[model samples]
Target: MSAFGTLLWLEFRKQGTFAMGMLMVVAGWSLLLRQFFAWGAEPSIVALAVVASTLMLAGAVVTAYLLWLGLDFAREYRNGRWALLLGAPQPGWLHLSARLLFACGVLTLFAAGMWGTLAFWLGRVGLEWPLGLGLALWAYGLGGVALVVPVLFIGLLVAAYLPARADLLAFLVGLLGLGQLLEWSLRLFSAQFYRWLPPWGLPLPRLGEMAWEGFPGLPSEAFVLLVLLCVLLFSAMSRLWQEVEV
Candidate 1:
């Protein structure tokens, strides 16, 4: 395998147990919806149940993946493996790119799968395509990665600076959990305040409002903005990594 492939594969191996657990959780949710249908409901009620179940699945999957990505970055830093990898033959950007690909690929799969299931269920409910939901879901998943990338970067920096109170691993993981708190607080602020920021300002409103009709979905300009922001933040992160002292 190439360097990128090797790194991604290693990360994938580490994630197998978590992935299996999530799969079981999804299966259980599917069973619960099935149970609701078996309880003898009208078609309309069944359709409602399915939509509710699908939304629940999407919410859980997104939250879990974000937390997992944050924790994973912190764990690598705590173990000193991040520094070790950076010292190796691979470039820092390559290493980070691999990690980002792994994160985005896994979370995107979960998000897409949940929405695909929803699309199937809606079809059964006699609903048609262009329900104007799928693109919003896709953008939300991509935009989510864009938002979390900086969190992971900042979490690693914080972990490196903090003292080893408990195990480094424990402290690092806890630092990553701090991202969830950051996310919650950001939601409390209005977008009018946040839009000045690059990444969070872009995704937050679209994800919350499901407004696929405007800049993000319809206009190619939004796509350009998203790409530019990702590149800028990623470059800043690389510079920080390079400047970190051993």
Candidate 2:
């Protein structure tokens, strides 16, 4: 295998079990929610839409995965594994890239599983899949990924910069709290004010709502801008990793 491939495979081996455990938690919650919707009183379309939006815009689920992967990288750094990897032939960017790619793959799978559960619930409740929910779910999942890129990147930064595991945990908590504050602030501000701000004002709930409202294709402009931001963040992270004192 190539260096990048080897690094990616090692990352998967280290984090795959934890990733699976997180997936199982999501699956269990999904099943319970499905049963509640199934056995509980009949739900209106609005209620269903609200629930669907909430499921797609689940920040907690995304944050949990981010923290898991972030701590894994931090653990490597603290345990001297990161220094050993740096001794290898490949550049530091390749190492960071491998972790980022692995994170993207894991998050895509997480979105898929969450969407599949939502679809299953919709099907059991006598809703058609393709015509009723499939396209919207696809759009939401893609948008969700776009929403997650920066977040995961931020997590990586925290892990790489902070020395202690407890510090990493505290940073993540503060980060999540700050994100929630920004989200709320965006909502509270005027639409005109939001338009004046950067794309960060456009939160996941808005993206999910657009999907639910049948906006076609990917949110192309937002996705492209986010991809660019991820690239910038990745470059910065690579530089930081190289400069860190062991």
Q: Which candidate is the best by lDDT?
A: 1
TM-score of 1: 0.67
| Top candidate (TM-score) | 1
**Per model, how many backbone clashes are there?**
0, 0
Candidate 2: pairs in clash: none
State every prediction's TM-score relative to the real structure: 0.67, 0.59
TM-score of 2: 0.59
lDDT of each: 0.63, 0.59
Minimum summed lDDT over a 10-residue window in model 2 is located at: 200-209
| Candidate 1 structure quality by residue, lDDT tens digits, 1-246 | 798889888878977667666666666665565665575776666766777767777777778777887787677767888668656767667777877787777766665666566666556545443434566666766777786756746654554554544346654664575556455545543334345545422232222223335444333334445576578668866765665544
Q: After superposing candidate 2 on the true structure, give the runs of residues whose Cα lies further than 4 Å from its correct spot.
A: 37-40, 45-58, 128-220, 236-245
Per-residue lDDT, model 1, residue 38, is 74
Which lDDT tens digits does candidate 2 get at residues 64-158? 66667557656766787766765666776888678766776776677667656665665565643343244344444445544444554565456
